[model samples]
Target: MMRKQTPWLALALLTLAPAALAQKTKVDAPPKKLYCWNENGQRVCSDALPPEAVNYAREEISAKSGLRTGEVNRTLTAEERAQAAAEAAQRALDKAAEDTRRRTDQAMLMSYRTEDDLRRVFNERTAIVDNNVQTARYNVASLREGLISLLQTAGDRELSERPVSAEMTQNIRLRHAELVRQRQLQASFESQRGELDIEIEDILQRYRTMKGSLPADSAPAATTP
Candidate 1:
């Protein structure tokens, strides 16, 4: 009975050998077509890239499933490439500028507590310039008085038929020069004050705008291209 069972087992093994070989063949088969293209209204497929695909649209198909993966993108022209580069550069510049502005706004908001804070600082800075202007004006007034006194003395000597001494002549020239110098200094101070006023106004306006829009607890943001 054991010998009879051994022969039956051998027969069963031989019968299963062909099926195993078939399964192995299927598994080891070459890859199927991965791409297809339309040629004169007919679909053509190949595992290798088609030579005529230079101008033809390529449709990528899965090798295992025979389904479309996606359509391949075409090559860009020189003009298209240049335009895209220009647009990308412009976008980068715009992003950089925006990031700088955001950081500036954040810094401004953090530095000052309120709109009045900006105003207070502005007044404080402008006050220094105002002080300079006042000092210059005072100097101008003093010089003008001295100039008038010297001119009157010169007139007295001329009326008395006395030759105006060289020393007196030199004194009058020096006084006039001092008066001109003080007037120029006054004008410069006035100009500087005006510029300071404009700067203060600009800074105040920027502060007001940033404070209105930015949150009190806003954090610095990272920028990306």
Candidate 2:
């Protein structure tokens, strides 16, 4: 015959039942999470990700909250990495080019007081190049005249039914080559003159732009031509 349970003991057991059940429910419940990723052009969702899906970009959501809590960025493929590297290199090259242009502009502004000053310097350079061209032209003419004389002599020998000597043949070849070279030199000098004109114009344009942006008091006075 068991003794009757005490009223206080019975009350305690009744009070503990709900707390014990709540603890058990919390332990037994699955973690609340939702993972989403792109697979084969479709969006897939699961409580956990597969090993293959680890390489794909994914988002983690709280199942209870239905909001994104975390993200995992995918690893880049070889092609994507290469493209990124190429773009980076091109950006570096562009930046370097821009820096060089800026420095050149600054230097130009510092060197020239006015557009006329710039033009005067370039004009002097052009005159020097013109003189070089004239000298080359004179040399070319002289060489051409010498080659023509050699050819005439060779023709005369041929008319007399005589073989042109090897020395004379060699001389003619040398003279002809010299004439060609002199003509090329003259053309090069002329090209330099043209390039100078283009360079001066470009400099003037940039200088004018920089000066125009300056305060009127700070800007240099324009010179008379």
Candidate 3:
């Protein structure tokens, strides 16, 4: 019975020996990393990071291999943080503007079959603005003539030692005001016409660019009148 127990004990010892040795080896192994950073312009290294080095740039090095494994960037200053935020905001705005522009270009390409169609629409718009301007100009001229006649009549009354009537005075003031208003309207219409011209030219240039990018079969040919 003693001899049989001895063999069983030896078998158990052999099985447990490797696991014990593995545990001992793991516990005795060197640390994997050392945290290092600059302190007062001097290099400082430690197995554990210090509180003072938390916001500073740091490097991780293998304790056994003595090779740098990784790095941590320093915390940004307030000004740098603000600048980064501004740059991010500007990028977002630029992306939004680019998206809007792309949508507009796509809409323009889908709406107009040819450059002639685009021009025809713009031409009609400008024609309406031109008619408004012409009408305003005619009204202004007519009002100015009426005002001039009233002023001349007042002058004649003063020269003849007769007082100007209140009714005539009121008519002169009303006509002058109407003339100024009509002149302003004429100027506004002219400005609209100019803006339309610029807008149409820009759209035509963009249209040509869009057309040029398409396959030859897909592009519209210029129509001759």
Candidate 1, position 128, lDDT: 84
Give each prediction's root-mean-square deviation over alpha carbons: 16.3, 9.2, 9.8
TM-score of each: 0.50, 0.55, 0.54
Please list all clashing residue pairs in model 2, or write none if there are none: none
User: How do the residues 139-223 of candidate 3 rate in per-residue lDDT, one tens digit apiece?
Assistant: 9889999999999999999999999999999999999988989999999999998998898898899999998898878755444
Tens-digit lDDT string for candidate 2 (1-225): 999876998799999999999999999997689999999999999998889898999999999899999998998999999999999999999999999999988776766787777777776778889899899999998998899999999999999999999999999999998888999999999898888778878878888899889887776544445
lDDT of 1 at 88: 100
- Give per-residue CA lDDT, model 1, range 1-225, as digits (tens): 354345877898899999999999999986575777777899878778856665567788888887887897656778989999999999999999989977977777767676765577667768888998999899889888988988888899899988888998898899889889988988998999989888778877887777677665773342322
Best by lDDT: 3
Winner on TM-score (1 vs 3): 3
Q: After superposition, how far is residue 205 of candidate 1 from its true place, in Å?
A: 0.7
TM-score (C-alpha) between model 2 and the true structure: 0.55
lDDT of 1: 0.80
